[model samples]
Target: MSSSMASSLPPLPRRVGWVGTGVMGLSMATHLLSAGHSLTVFNRTASKAAPLLDKGAKLADSPRAVAEQSEVVFVIVGYPSDVRRVALDPDHGVLPGLRPGSILVDMSTSDPSLAEEIAIAAASVSCQAVDAPVSGGDRGAREGKLSIFAGGDRSTVELLSPLFEKLGVLNYMGGPGSGQRAKLGNQIAIASTMVGLVEGMVFAHRSGLDVTRWIKAIASGAAGSKSLELYGERILRRDMAAGFFVHHFVKDLGICLRECQAMGLALPGLALAQQLYLSLIAHGEGNLGTQALILAIERLNNTRLGDGGESSG
Candidate 1:
Protein backbone atom coordinates (compact mmCIF):
# COMPACT_ATOMS: atom_id res chain seq x y z
CA MET A 1 0.00 0.00 0.00
CA SER A 2 1.15 3.54 0.83
CA SER A 3 4.26 4.43 2.80
CA SER A 4 2.19 6.45 5.26
CA MET A 5 -0.05 3.44 5.82
CA ALA A 6 2.87 1.10 6.61
CA SER A 7 4.37 3.70 8.91
CA SER A 8 1.17 3.76 10.90
CA LEU A 9 1.20 -0.01 11.65
CA PRO A 10 2.55 -1.65 14.77
CA PRO A 11 6.09 -2.96 14.79
CA LEU A 12 6.77 -6.68 14.33
CA PRO A 13 7.67 -8.76 17.39
CA ARG A 14 11.28 -8.54 18.50
CA ARG A 15 11.58 -12.32 18.77
CA VAL A 16 12.17 -13.85 15.31
CA GLY A 17 12.82 -17.41 14.14
CA TRP A 18 14.47 -18.08 10.79
CA VAL A 19 14.79 -21.38 8.95
CA GLY A 20 17.11 -21.90 5.97
CA THR A 21 20.42 -20.02 6.03
CA GLY A 22 21.68 -20.81 2.60
CA VAL A 23 23.01 -18.12 0.19
CA MET A 24 20.23 -15.52 0.33
CA GLY A 25 18.68 -16.61 3.63
CA LEU A 26 21.86 -15.84 5.56
CA SER A 27 21.83 -12.21 4.47
CA MET A 28 18.06 -11.84 4.96
CA ALA A 29 18.11 -13.21 8.52
CA THR A 30 21.10 -11.09 9.37
CA HIS A 31 19.06 -7.95 8.63
CA LEU A 32 16.46 -8.89 11.25
CA LEU A 33 19.12 -9.49 13.87
CA SER A 34 20.84 -6.28 12.88
CA ALA A 35 17.58 -4.45 13.53
CA GLY A 36 17.93 -5.52 17.19
CA HIS A 37 15.60 -8.49 17.09
CA SER A 38 16.32 -11.61 19.14
CA LEU A 39 16.77 -14.30 16.55
CA THR A 40 16.65 -18.11 16.67
CA VAL A 41 17.77 -19.95 13.54
CA PHE A 42 17.85 -23.54 12.18
CA ASN A 43 19.36 -25.06 9.07
CA ARG A 44 19.90 -28.67 7.99
CA THR A 45 23.63 -27.98 8.06
CA ALA A 46 24.39 -26.10 11.29
CA SER A 47 27.61 -24.81 9.79
CA LYS A 48 25.64 -22.85 7.23
CA ALA A 49 23.92 -21.05 10.08
CA ALA A 50 27.26 -20.35 11.76
CA PRO A 51 27.51 -16.77 10.54
CA LEU A 52 24.15 -15.87 12.04
CA LEU A 53 25.05 -17.68 15.24
CA ASP A 54 28.31 -15.78 15.47
CA LYS A 55 26.33 -12.58 15.09
CA GLY A 56 24.27 -13.35 18.25
CA ALA A 57 21.42 -15.47 16.86
CA LYS A 58 20.54 -18.66 18.77
CA LEU A 59 20.84 -21.93 16.92
CA ALA A 60 17.66 -23.96 17.26
CA ASP A 61 17.91 -27.75 16.94
CA SER A 62 14.78 -27.99 14.83
CA PRO A 63 12.20 -25.85 12.99
CA ARG A 64 9.78 -26.54 15.87
CA ALA A 65 12.30 -25.28 18.39
CA VAL A 66 12.76 -22.09 16.44
CA ALA A 67 9.02 -21.48 16.31
CA GLU A 68 8.58 -22.08 20.03
CA GLN A 69 11.06 -19.32 20.82
CA SER A 70 9.77 -16.91 18.18
CA GLU A 71 6.75 -14.67 17.73
CA VAL A 72 7.35 -14.25 14.01
CA VAL A 73 8.90 -17.26 12.30
CA PHE A 74 10.21 -17.16 8.71
CA VAL A 75 10.92 -20.11 6.40
CA ILE A 76 12.98 -19.64 3.18
CA VAL A 77 14.20 -23.00 2.06
CA GLY A 78 15.02 -24.57 -1.36
CA TYR A 79 12.03 -26.50 -2.67
CA PRO A 80 8.26 -26.69 -2.12
CA SER A 81 8.83 -30.11 -0.54
CA ASP A 82 11.27 -28.59 1.92
CA VAL A 83 8.75 -25.86 2.72
CA ARG A 84 6.10 -28.54 3.37
CA ARG A 85 8.46 -30.45 5.64
CA VAL A 86 9.80 -27.50 7.61
CA ALA A 87 6.44 -25.77 8.05
CA LEU A 88 3.99 -28.69 8.04
CA ASP A 89 5.82 -31.82 9.19
CA PRO A 90 3.49 -33.00 12.00
CA ASP A 91 6.30 -33.89 14.35
CA HIS A 92 8.86 -31.11 13.94
CA GLY A 93 7.27 -28.52 11.69
CA VAL A 94 6.85 -24.91 12.74
CA LEU A 95 3.05 -25.25 12.99
CA PRO A 96 3.24 -27.65 15.93
CA GLY A 97 5.31 -25.25 18.02
CA LEU A 98 3.45 -22.11 17.05
CA ARG A 99 1.36 -20.49 19.76
CA PRO A 100 -1.96 -18.89 18.95
CA GLY A 101 -1.48 -15.41 17.50
CA SER A 102 2.09 -16.12 16.38
CA ILE A 103 2.92 -15.29 12.77
CA LEU A 104 4.38 -17.72 10.24
CA VAL A 105 5.99 -16.06 7.22
CA ASP A 106 7.23 -18.22 4.36
CA MET A 107 9.57 -16.43 1.90
CA SER A 108 10.31 -19.42 -0.27
CA THR A 109 9.59 -19.51 -4.04
CA SER A 110 7.13 -22.38 -3.79
CA ASP A 111 3.79 -23.51 -5.15
CA PRO A 112 0.88 -21.12 -4.61
CA SER A 113 -1.37 -24.03 -3.65
CA LEU A 114 1.13 -24.97 -0.95
CA ALA A 115 0.98 -21.43 0.38
CA GLU A 116 -2.80 -21.76 0.60
CA GLU A 117 -2.37 -25.03 2.47
CA ILE A 118 0.03 -23.38 4.94
CA ALA A 119 -2.39 -20.51 5.60
CA ILE A 120 -5.16 -23.00 6.30
CA ALA A 121 -2.94 -25.10 8.57
CA ALA A 122 -1.87 -22.08 10.55
CA ALA A 123 -5.50 -21.01 10.88
CA SER A 124 -6.37 -24.39 12.36
CA VAL A 125 -3.77 -23.76 15.05
CA SER A 126 -4.98 -20.16 15.53
CA CYS A 127 -1.78 -18.75 14.07
CA GLN A 128 -1.44 -16.51 11.01
CA ALA A 129 0.51 -17.40 7.88
CA VAL A 130 1.84 -15.02 5.21
CA ASP A 131 3.45 -15.90 1.93
CA ALA A 132 6.11 -13.34 1.02
CA PRO A 133 8.39 -14.52 -1.74
CA VAL A 134 11.22 -12.13 -2.63
CA SER A 135 13.06 -11.03 -5.76
CA GLY A 136 16.54 -9.49 -6.32
CA GLY A 137 19.38 -11.98 -6.14
CA ASP A 138 22.18 -12.39 -3.56
CA ARG A 139 23.55 -8.88 -3.96
CA GLY A 140 20.12 -7.33 -3.42
CA ALA A 141 19.61 -9.54 -0.39
CA ARG A 142 22.97 -8.49 1.04
CA GLU A 143 22.18 -4.84 0.38
CA GLY A 144 18.68 -5.13 1.90
CA LYS A 145 17.14 -3.91 -1.35
CA LEU A 146 14.92 -6.85 -2.25
CA SER A 147 11.36 -6.43 -3.56
CA ILE A 148 9.11 -8.45 -1.24
CA PHE A 149 5.71 -9.56 -2.53
CA ALA A 150 3.53 -10.44 0.44
CA GLY A 151 0.21 -12.33 0.45
CA GLY A 152 -2.10 -12.81 3.39
CA ASP A 153 -4.87 -10.91 5.08
CA ARG A 154 -4.34 -7.26 4.20
CA SER A 155 -4.22 -6.24 7.84
CA THR A 156 -1.74 -8.96 8.79
CA VAL A 157 0.51 -8.17 5.86
CA GLU A 158 0.45 -4.51 6.73
CA LEU A 159 1.30 -5.30 10.34
CA LEU A 160 4.49 -6.95 9.09
CA SER A 161 5.51 -3.86 7.11
CA PRO A 162 7.87 -2.60 9.80
CA LEU A 163 9.84 -5.84 9.79
CA PHE A 164 9.65 -6.19 6.02
CA GLU A 165 10.86 -2.62 5.61
CA LYS A 166 14.05 -3.71 7.35
CA LEU A 167 14.68 -6.04 4.43
CA GLY A 168 13.16 -4.18 1.46
CA VAL A 169 10.11 -2.71 -0.21
CA LEU A 170 6.97 -4.68 0.68
CA ASN A 171 3.99 -5.02 -1.65
CA TYR A 172 0.92 -6.74 -0.25
CA MET A 173 -0.40 -8.63 -3.26
CA GLY A 174 -3.64 -10.09 -1.87
CA GLY A 175 -4.82 -13.29 -0.10
CA PRO A 176 -2.62 -16.28 0.70
CA GLY A 177 -0.73 -17.66 -2.36
CA SER A 178 -0.95 -14.41 -4.33
CA GLY A 179 2.64 -13.58 -3.42
CA GLN A 180 3.70 -16.89 -4.92
CA ARG A 181 1.77 -16.23 -8.11
CA ALA A 182 3.48 -12.86 -8.35
CA LYS A 183 6.85 -14.52 -7.88
CA LEU A 184 6.04 -17.05 -10.61
CA GLY A 185 5.24 -14.18 -12.95
CA ASN A 186 8.57 -12.68 -11.94
CA GLN A 187 10.34 -15.93 -12.83
CA ILE A 188 8.66 -16.07 -16.21
CA ALA A 189 9.89 -12.60 -17.06
CA ILE A 190 13.40 -13.37 -15.78
CA ALA A 191 13.55 -16.60 -17.78
CA SER A 192 12.86 -14.81 -21.04
CA THR A 193 15.20 -11.91 -20.23
CA MET A 194 18.03 -14.28 -19.35
CA VAL A 195 17.62 -16.15 -22.62
CA GLY A 196 17.69 -12.94 -24.60
CA LEU A 197 20.73 -11.63 -22.67
CA VAL A 198 22.84 -14.77 -23.19
CA GLU A 199 21.90 -15.10 -26.82
CA GLY A 200 22.95 -11.48 -27.45
CA MET A 201 26.28 -12.13 -25.72
CA VAL A 202 26.88 -15.20 -27.86
CA PHE A 203 26.04 -13.27 -30.99
CA ALA A 204 28.46 -10.54 -29.96
CA HIS A 205 31.25 -13.01 -29.23
CA ARG A 206 30.89 -14.67 -32.63
CA SER A 207 30.85 -11.38 -34.54
CA GLY A 208 34.33 -10.35 -33.27
CA LEU A 209 32.76 -7.53 -31.24
CA ASP A 210 34.20 -6.59 -27.85
CA VAL A 211 31.64 -8.45 -25.73
CA THR A 212 32.47 -6.34 -22.67
CA ARG A 213 32.05 -3.08 -24.57
CA TRP A 214 28.89 -4.36 -26.19
CA ILE A 215 27.35 -4.94 -22.74
CA LYS A 216 28.23 -1.42 -21.62
CA ALA A 217 26.79 0.15 -24.76
CA ILE A 218 23.43 -1.59 -24.54
CA ALA A 219 23.12 -1.71 -20.72
CA SER A 220 21.81 1.86 -20.49
CA GLY A 221 19.68 1.67 -23.62
CA ALA A 222 16.23 0.15 -24.17
CA ALA A 223 18.00 -3.22 -24.38
CA GLY A 224 19.18 -2.94 -20.76
CA SER A 225 17.64 -5.02 -17.97
CA LYS A 226 18.27 -5.96 -14.36
CA SER A 227 19.35 -9.42 -15.48
CA LEU A 228 21.93 -7.84 -17.76
CA GLU A 229 23.16 -5.49 -15.04
CA LEU A 230 23.45 -8.26 -12.44
CA TYR A 231 24.87 -11.13 -14.45
CA GLY A 232 26.61 -9.57 -17.44
CA GLU A 233 30.03 -9.20 -15.86
CA ARG A 234 29.69 -12.54 -14.10
CA ILE A 235 29.16 -14.20 -17.47
CA LEU A 236 32.09 -12.28 -18.95
CA ARG A 237 34.39 -13.48 -16.17
CA ARG A 238 33.05 -17.05 -16.38
CA ASP A 239 32.16 -16.88 -12.69
CA MET A 240 29.29 -19.30 -12.34
CA ALA A 241 29.14 -19.48 -8.56
CA ALA A 242 25.65 -19.81 -7.12
CA GLY A 243 24.25 -16.33 -6.70
CA PHE A 244 20.99 -18.07 -7.58
CA PHE A 245 21.38 -21.78 -8.12
CA VAL A 246 20.58 -23.20 -11.57
CA HIS A 247 18.71 -26.13 -10.08
CA HIS A 248 16.45 -23.91 -7.96
CA PHE A 249 15.62 -21.76 -11.00
CA VAL A 250 14.58 -24.91 -12.85
CA LYS A 251 12.20 -25.74 -9.99
CA ASP A 252 10.74 -22.20 -10.17
CA LEU A 253 10.23 -22.48 -13.92
CA GLY A 254 8.64 -25.90 -13.49
CA ILE A 255 6.14 -24.36 -11.12
CA CYS A 256 5.48 -21.55 -13.61
CA LEU A 257 4.85 -24.03 -16.41
CA ARG A 258 2.45 -26.02 -14.26
CA GLU A 259 0.60 -22.86 -13.28
CA CYS A 260 0.44 -21.77 -16.90
CA GLN A 261 -0.97 -25.14 -17.95
CA ALA A 262 -3.66 -24.90 -15.31
CA MET A 263 -4.57 -21.44 -16.66
CA GLY A 264 -4.61 -22.60 -20.30
CA LEU A 265 -1.80 -20.20 -21.20
CA ALA A 266 1.08 -20.91 -23.58
CA LEU A 267 4.46 -19.31 -22.89
CA PRO A 268 6.87 -20.69 -25.43
CA GLY A 269 9.67 -18.41 -24.22
CA LEU A 270 9.42 -19.76 -20.68
CA ALA A 271 9.24 -23.30 -22.04
CA LEU A 272 12.42 -22.75 -24.07
CA ALA A 273 14.25 -21.30 -21.08
CA GLN A 274 13.23 -24.28 -18.93
CA GLN A 275 14.60 -26.78 -21.43
CA LEU A 276 17.87 -24.85 -21.68
CA TYR A 277 18.21 -24.72 -17.89
CA LEU A 278 17.30 -28.41 -17.62
CA SER A 279 20.20 -29.16 -19.93
CA LEU A 280 22.51 -27.50 -17.42
CA ILE A 281 21.22 -29.78 -14.68
CA ALA A 282 21.75 -32.76 -16.96
CA HIS A 283 25.33 -31.63 -17.61
CA GLY A 284 26.12 -31.38 -13.87
CA GLU A 285 26.08 -27.57 -13.80
CA GLY A 286 22.96 -27.36 -11.66
CA ASN A 287 24.89 -25.82 -8.81
CA LEU A 288 26.09 -22.92 -10.97
CA GLY A 289 24.49 -19.51 -11.32
CA THR A 290 21.59 -18.73 -13.71
CA GLN A 291 24.14 -16.80 -15.80
CA ALA A 292 25.43 -20.24 -16.70
CA LEU A 293 22.60 -20.42 -19.19
CA ILE A 294 25.27 -18.97 -21.43
CA LEU A 295 26.97 -22.34 -21.22
CA ALA A 296 23.92 -24.13 -22.55
CA ILE A 297 23.55 -21.62 -25.37
CA GLU A 298 27.25 -21.95 -26.18
CA ARG A 299 26.89 -25.70 -26.42
CA LEU A 300 23.98 -25.42 -28.80
CA ASN A 301 25.87 -23.05 -31.11
CA ASN A 302 29.24 -24.89 -30.72
CA THR A 303 30.94 -21.56 -29.91
CA ARG A 304 32.39 -20.51 -26.56
CA LEU A 305 32.21 -16.88 -25.53
CA GLY A 306 35.40 -14.77 -25.43
CA ASP A 307 37.96 -17.50 -26.26
CA GLY A 308 36.98 -18.11 -29.89
CA GLY A 309 36.94 -21.86 -29.19
CA GLU A 310 34.18 -24.39 -29.78
CA SER A 311 32.23 -25.68 -26.78
CA SER A 312 33.43 -29.03 -25.49
CA GLY A 313 29.88 -30.20 -24.97
Candidate 2:
Protein backbone atom coordinates (compact mmCIF):
# COMPACT_ATOMS: atom_id res chain seq x y z
CA MET A 1 0.00 0.00 0.00
CA SER A 2 1.08 3.59 -0.59
CA SER A 3 1.17 6.46 1.88
CA SER A 4 -2.46 7.43 1.44
CA MET A 5 -4.25 8.39 4.63
CA ALA A 6 -6.32 5.63 6.24
CA SER A 7 -9.31 8.01 6.52
CA SER A 8 -9.46 8.03 2.72
CA LEU A 9 -10.08 4.31 2.40
CA PRO A 10 -13.23 3.80 0.37
CA PRO A 11 -15.82 1.04 0.30
CA LEU A 12 -15.52 0.62 4.04
CA PRO A 13 -17.36 -2.23 5.69
CA ARG A 14 -20.70 -1.65 7.39
CA ARG A 15 -19.39 -2.17 10.91
CA VAL A 16 -15.96 -3.17 12.25
CA GLY A 17 -15.27 -4.73 15.64
CA TRP A 18 -11.84 -5.02 17.24
CA VAL A 19 -10.85 -7.33 20.05
CA GLY A 20 -7.58 -7.07 21.99
CA THR A 21 -6.51 -3.54 22.78
CA GLY A 22 -2.93 -4.14 23.79
CA VAL A 23 0.08 -2.28 22.36
CA MET A 24 -0.25 -3.23 18.67
CA GLY A 25 -4.01 -3.71 18.59
CA LEU A 26 -4.69 -0.21 19.90
CA SER A 27 -3.00 1.49 16.94
CA MET A 28 -4.42 -0.90 14.36
CA ALA A 29 -7.98 -0.41 15.56
CA THR A 30 -7.44 3.33 15.62
CA HIS A 31 -6.68 3.25 11.90
CA LEU A 32 -10.05 1.72 11.15
CA LEU A 33 -11.80 4.11 13.51
CA SER A 34 -10.09 7.12 11.95
CA ALA A 35 -11.21 5.90 8.53
CA GLY A 36 -14.82 6.59 9.65
CA HIS A 37 -15.73 2.95 9.96
CA SER A 38 -18.27 2.30 12.69
CA LEU A 39 -16.12 0.46 15.24
CA THR A 40 -16.92 -1.45 18.43
CA VAL A 41 -13.98 -2.57 20.56
CA PHE A 42 -13.40 -4.93 23.49
CA ASN A 43 -10.40 -5.88 25.60
CA ARG A 44 -9.97 -8.10 28.60
CA THR A 45 -8.77 -5.09 30.53
CA ALA A 46 -11.15 -2.15 30.24
CA SER A 47 -8.54 0.48 31.11
CA LYS A 48 -6.34 -0.50 28.18
CA ALA A 49 -9.25 0.00 25.79
CA ALA A 50 -9.92 3.47 27.13
CA PRO A 51 -7.87 5.26 24.47
CA LEU A 52 -9.95 3.79 21.67
CA LEU A 53 -13.09 4.77 23.53
CA ASP A 54 -11.82 8.32 23.74
CA LYS A 55 -11.36 8.27 19.99
CA GLY A 56 -15.11 7.58 19.52
CA ALA A 57 -15.11 3.81 19.37
CA LYS A 58 -17.96 2.24 21.33
CA LEU A 59 -17.04 -0.19 24.07
CA ALA A 60 -18.41 -3.71 23.83
CA ASP A 61 -18.81 -5.68 27.04
CA SER A 62 -17.19 -8.79 25.62
CA PRO A 63 -15.86 -10.45 22.48
CA ARG A 64 -19.31 -11.87 21.83
CA ALA A 65 -20.78 -8.41 22.06
CA VAL A 66 -18.32 -7.05 19.52
CA ALA A 67 -18.89 -9.96 17.16
CA GLU A 68 -22.63 -9.58 17.29
CA GLN A 69 -22.49 -5.94 16.31
CA SER A 70 -19.90 -5.91 13.51
CA GLU A 71 -19.78 -7.41 10.05
CA VAL A 72 -16.02 -7.86 10.21
CA VAL A 73 -14.10 -8.47 13.44
CA PHE A 74 -10.33 -8.03 13.86
CA VAL A 75 -8.37 -9.68 16.70
CA ILE A 76 -4.70 -9.02 17.56
CA VAL A 77 -4.20 -10.29 21.07
CA GLY A 78 -1.08 -11.55 22.91
CA TYR A 79 -0.73 -15.29 22.33
CA PRO A 80 -2.39 -18.31 20.75
CA SER A 81 -4.10 -19.07 24.07
CA ASP A 82 -5.42 -15.53 24.32
CA VAL A 83 -6.57 -15.72 20.70
CA ARG A 84 -8.38 -18.97 21.45
CA ARG A 85 -10.07 -17.48 24.49
CA VAL A 86 -11.35 -14.39 22.71
CA ALA A 87 -12.02 -16.11 19.38
CA LEU A 88 -13.07 -19.67 20.10
CA ASP A 89 -14.30 -19.99 23.66
CA PRO A 90 -17.76 -21.55 23.45
CA ASP A 91 -19.90 -19.22 25.54
CA HIS A 92 -18.42 -15.74 25.34
CA GLY A 93 -15.99 -15.87 22.42
CA VAL A 94 -16.41 -14.11 19.10
CA LEU A 95 -17.35 -17.28 17.25
CA PRO A 96 -20.58 -17.69 19.23
CA GLY A 97 -21.76 -14.24 18.19
CA LEU A 98 -20.46 -13.95 14.63
CA ARG A 99 -23.04 -14.13 11.88
CA PRO A 100 -22.78 -16.75 9.18
CA GLY A 101 -21.31 -14.60 6.42
CA SER A 102 -19.20 -12.34 8.60
CA ILE A 103 -15.38 -12.36 8.59
CA LEU A 104 -12.85 -12.92 11.42
CA VAL A 105 -9.26 -11.75 11.03
CA ASP A 106 -6.55 -12.90 13.42
CA MET A 107 -3.54 -10.56 13.31
CA SER A 108 -1.67 -12.03 16.24
CA THR A 109 1.60 -13.90 15.66
CA SER A 110 0.46 -17.32 16.82
CA ASP A 111 0.59 -21.04 16.11
CA PRO A 112 -0.25 -22.27 12.62
CA SER A 113 -2.22 -25.21 13.97
CA LEU A 114 -4.41 -22.92 16.07
CA ALA A 115 -5.05 -20.82 12.99
CA GLU A 116 -6.28 -23.92 11.22
CA GLU A 117 -8.45 -24.78 14.20
CA ILE A 118 -10.00 -21.34 14.13
CA ALA A 119 -10.65 -21.70 10.39
CA ILE A 120 -12.44 -24.95 10.99
CA ALA A 121 -14.49 -23.61 13.88
CA ALA A 122 -15.49 -20.50 11.97
CA ALA A 123 -16.32 -22.67 8.98
CA SER A 124 -18.60 -24.78 11.09
CA VAL A 125 -20.54 -21.63 11.88
CA SER A 126 -20.41 -20.52 8.20
CA CYS A 127 -18.14 -17.63 9.13
CA GLN A 128 -15.01 -16.78 7.14
CA ALA A 129 -11.64 -16.69 8.97
CA VAL A 130 -8.21 -15.39 8.05
CA ASP A 131 -4.94 -15.86 9.84
CA ALA A 132 -3.13 -12.61 9.00
CA PRO A 133 -0.14 -12.18 11.30
CA VAL A 134 1.79 -8.93 10.92
CA SER A 135 5.35 -7.55 11.15
CA GLY A 136 7.05 -4.10 11.47
CA GLY A 137 6.15 -4.08 15.15
CA ASP A 138 4.62 -1.20 17.14
CA ARG A 139 6.16 1.48 14.94
CA GLY A 140 4.54 -0.10 11.93
CA ALA A 141 1.18 -0.45 13.63
CA ARG A 142 1.23 3.12 14.94
CA GLU A 143 2.31 4.41 11.52
CA GLY A 144 -0.13 2.17 9.61
CA LYS A 145 2.80 0.65 7.71
CA LEU A 146 2.54 -2.96 8.89
CA SER A 147 3.24 -5.83 6.51
CA ILE A 148 0.26 -8.19 6.81
CA PHE A 149 0.69 -11.82 5.74
CA ALA A 150 -2.77 -13.28 5.11
CA GLY A 151 -3.90 -16.89 4.84
CA GLY A 152 -7.48 -17.64 3.87
CA ASP A 153 -9.75 -18.08 0.89
CA ARG A 154 -8.78 -15.84 -2.04
CA SER A 155 -12.24 -14.34 -2.22
CA THR A 156 -12.23 -13.42 1.47
CA VAL A 157 -8.76 -11.93 1.21
CA GLU A 158 -9.69 -9.83 -1.81
CA LEU A 159 -12.85 -8.68 -0.10
CA LEU A 160 -10.80 -7.40 2.82
CA SER A 161 -8.17 -5.73 0.62
CA PRO A 162 -9.37 -2.15 1.00
CA LEU A 163 -9.36 -2.45 4.77
CA PHE A 164 -6.02 -4.30 4.85
CA GLU A 165 -4.50 -1.68 2.58
CA LYS A 166 -5.39 0.92 5.18
CA LEU A 167 -3.12 -0.89 7.64
CA GLY A 168 -0.23 -1.88 5.38
CA VAL A 169 0.92 -4.00 2.43
CA LEU A 170 -1.01 -7.24 2.14
CA ASN A 171 0.35 -10.53 0.78
CA TYR A 172 -1.80 -13.64 0.47
CA MET A 173 0.23 -16.75 1.21
CA GLY A 174 -2.19 -19.72 0.85
CA GLY A 175 -4.98 -21.61 2.64
CA PRO A 176 -5.64 -21.44 6.39
CA GLY A 177 -2.60 -21.13 8.70
CA SER A 178 -0.14 -20.20 5.94
CA GLY A 179 0.18 -16.67 7.26
CA GLN A 180 1.39 -18.08 10.56
CA ARG A 181 3.93 -20.26 8.75
CA ALA A 182 5.25 -17.21 6.94
CA LYS A 183 5.41 -15.24 10.20
CA LEU A 184 7.35 -18.02 11.92
CA GLY A 185 9.77 -17.98 9.01
CA ASN A 186 10.21 -14.26 9.63
CA GLN A 187 10.82 -14.83 13.35
CA ILE A 188 13.52 -17.39 12.61
CA ALA A 189 15.43 -14.91 10.49
CA ILE A 190 14.96 -12.14 13.05
CA ALA A 191 16.12 -14.45 15.83
CA SER A 192 19.40 -15.13 14.04
CA THR A 193 19.90 -11.48 13.08
CA MET A 194 19.33 -10.31 16.68
CA VAL A 195 22.03 -12.65 17.90
CA GLY A 196 24.41 -11.41 15.24
CA LEU A 197 23.51 -7.78 15.99
CA VAL A 198 24.09 -8.04 19.73
CA GLU A 199 27.32 -10.03 19.30
CA GLY A 200 28.69 -7.51 16.79
CA MET A 201 27.86 -4.61 19.13
CA VAL A 202 29.53 -6.44 22.02
CA PHE A 203 32.65 -6.97 19.97
CA ALA A 204 32.71 -3.29 18.99
CA HIS A 205 32.36 -2.16 22.63
CA ARG A 206 35.04 -4.60 23.75
CA SER A 207 37.41 -3.27 21.07
CA GLY A 208 36.94 0.34 22.32
CA LEU A 209 35.09 1.57 19.22
CA ASP A 210 32.09 3.89 19.55
CA VAL A 211 29.08 1.54 19.35
CA THR A 212 26.77 4.23 17.95
CA ARG A 213 29.34 5.33 15.33
CA TRP A 214 30.03 1.74 14.40
CA ILE A 215 26.31 1.16 13.74
CA LYS A 216 26.08 4.22 11.49
CA ALA A 217 29.28 3.26 9.62
CA ILE A 218 28.13 -0.28 8.77
CA ALA A 219 24.34 0.28 8.55
CA SER A 220 24.47 1.33 4.88
CA GLY A 221 26.74 -1.51 3.84
CA ALA A 222 26.45 -5.29 3.41
CA ALA A 223 26.00 -5.69 7.18
CA GLY A 224 22.89 -3.53 7.16
CA SER A 225 19.50 -5.11 7.91
CA LYS A 226 15.98 -4.08 8.86
CA SER A 227 16.64 -5.17 12.45
CA LEU A 228 19.94 -3.29 12.61
CA GLU A 229 18.52 -0.15 11.04
CA LEU A 230 15.41 -0.13 13.20
CA TYR A 231 16.62 -1.35 16.58
CA GLY A 232 20.37 -0.62 16.53
CA GLU A 233 20.06 2.99 17.68
CA ARG A 234 17.54 2.03 20.33
CA ILE A 235 19.99 -0.57 21.60
CA LEU A 236 22.75 2.03 21.62
CA ARG A 237 20.57 4.40 23.66
CA ARG A 238 19.58 1.53 25.99
CA ASP A 239 15.92 2.28 25.31
CA MET A 240 14.36 -1.04 26.18
CA ALA A 241 10.77 0.10 25.72
CA ALA A 242 8.99 -2.55 23.70
CA GLY A 243 8.49 -1.90 20.05
CA PHE A 244 7.94 -5.63 20.27
CA PHE A 245 8.10 -7.24 23.66
CA VAL A 246 10.76 -9.83 24.42
CA HIS A 247 8.14 -12.19 25.85
CA HIS A 248 6.11 -12.01 22.66
CA PHE A 249 9.16 -12.59 20.45
CA VAL A 250 10.10 -15.49 22.68
CA LYS A 251 6.63 -16.95 22.14
CA ASP A 252 7.06 -16.53 18.39
CA LEU A 253 10.47 -18.21 18.46
CA GLY A 254 9.07 -21.02 20.58
CA ILE A 255 6.47 -21.60 17.89
CA CYS A 256 9.18 -21.58 15.23
CA LEU A 257 11.26 -24.11 17.14
CA ARG A 258 8.24 -26.37 17.60
CA GLU A 259 7.43 -26.09 13.92
CA CYS A 260 11.04 -26.97 13.15
CA GLN A 261 10.82 -30.08 15.28
CA ALA A 262 7.62 -31.12 13.54
CA MET A 263 9.40 -30.81 10.20
CA GLY A 264 12.49 -32.67 11.43
CA LEU A 265 14.64 -29.58 11.02
CA ALA A 266 17.41 -28.49 13.38
CA LEU A 267 18.06 -24.74 13.31
CA PRO A 268 20.71 -24.24 15.96
CA GLY A 269 20.78 -20.47 15.58
CA LEU A 270 17.06 -20.15 16.30
CA ALA A 271 17.45 -22.48 19.28
CA LEU A 272 20.23 -20.35 20.71
CA ALA A 273 18.23 -17.16 20.32
CA GLN A 274 15.32 -18.72 22.11
CA GLN A 275 17.60 -19.74 24.96
CA LEU A 276 18.96 -16.20 25.27
CA TYR A 277 15.50 -14.64 25.28
CA LEU A 278 14.41 -17.13 27.92
CA SER A 279 17.30 -15.88 30.03
CA LEU A 280 15.92 -12.36 29.75
CA ILE A 281 12.51 -13.68 30.77
CA ALA A 282 14.14 -15.41 33.70
CA HIS A 283 15.59 -12.08 34.82
CA GLY A 284 12.04 -10.65 34.90
CA GLU A 285 12.72 -8.57 31.82
CA GLY A 286 10.12 -10.26 29.66
CA ASN A 287 8.07 -7.07 29.60
CA LEU A 288 10.99 -5.21 28.09
CA GLY A 289 11.34 -4.94 24.34
CA THR A 290 13.23 -7.44 22.18
CA GLN A 291 16.14 -4.98 21.96
CA ALA A 292 16.80 -5.90 25.59
CA LEU A 293 18.26 -9.15 24.31
CA ILE A 294 21.49 -7.21 24.42
CA LEU A 295 21.15 -7.31 28.21
CA ALA A 296 21.40 -11.07 28.15
CA ILE A 297 24.53 -10.82 26.03
CA GLU A 298 25.94 -8.26 28.44
CA ARG A 299 25.34 -10.66 31.29
CA LEU A 300 27.18 -13.44 29.48
CA ASN A 301 30.25 -11.30 28.74
CA ASN A 302 30.22 -9.38 32.06
CA THR A 303 30.01 -6.13 30.10
CA ARG A 304 27.62 -3.28 29.28
CA LEU A 305 26.41 -1.60 26.08
CA GLY A 306 28.55 1.57 26.10
CA ASP A 307 29.24 3.12 29.51
CA GLY A 308 30.01 -0.18 31.24
CA GLY A 309 27.50 0.12 34.10
CA GLU A 310 26.06 -2.92 35.84
CA SER A 311 23.09 -4.43 33.99
CA SER A 312 19.87 -3.07 35.51
CA GLY A 313 17.28 -5.46 36.81
Among the numbered candidates, top lDDT falls to 1
For residues 120-184, write the lDDT of model 2, one tens digit per residue: 89888878889999999888999999999999877788778988988999999999999999999
Q: Give each model a TM-score.
A: 0.95, 0.94
Model 2, 235: alpha-carbon shift in Å? 1.0
Off by over 4 Å in 1: 1-10, 307-313
Top TM-score prediction, candidate number: 1
- C-alpha lDDT of all candidate models, in order: 0.91, 0.88
lDDT of 1 by residue, 1-313 (tens): 2234333433668889999999999999999999999999999999999999899999999999999998889999999999999999999999999877788999999999999999999988877889999999998899999999999878788778888998899998999999999999999999999999999999888887888888899998999999999999888888899889999999999999999999999999999999999999999999999999999998999888763322222
TM-score, cand. 2 vs. native: 0.94
Clash count, one per candidate: 0, 0
Residue pairs clashing, model 1: none
Error of 1 at 46 (Å): 0.4
Candidate 2 residues lying further than 4 Å off, grouped into runs, are 1-11, 307-313
Candidate 2, residue 226: how far the Cα is off, in Å: 1.2
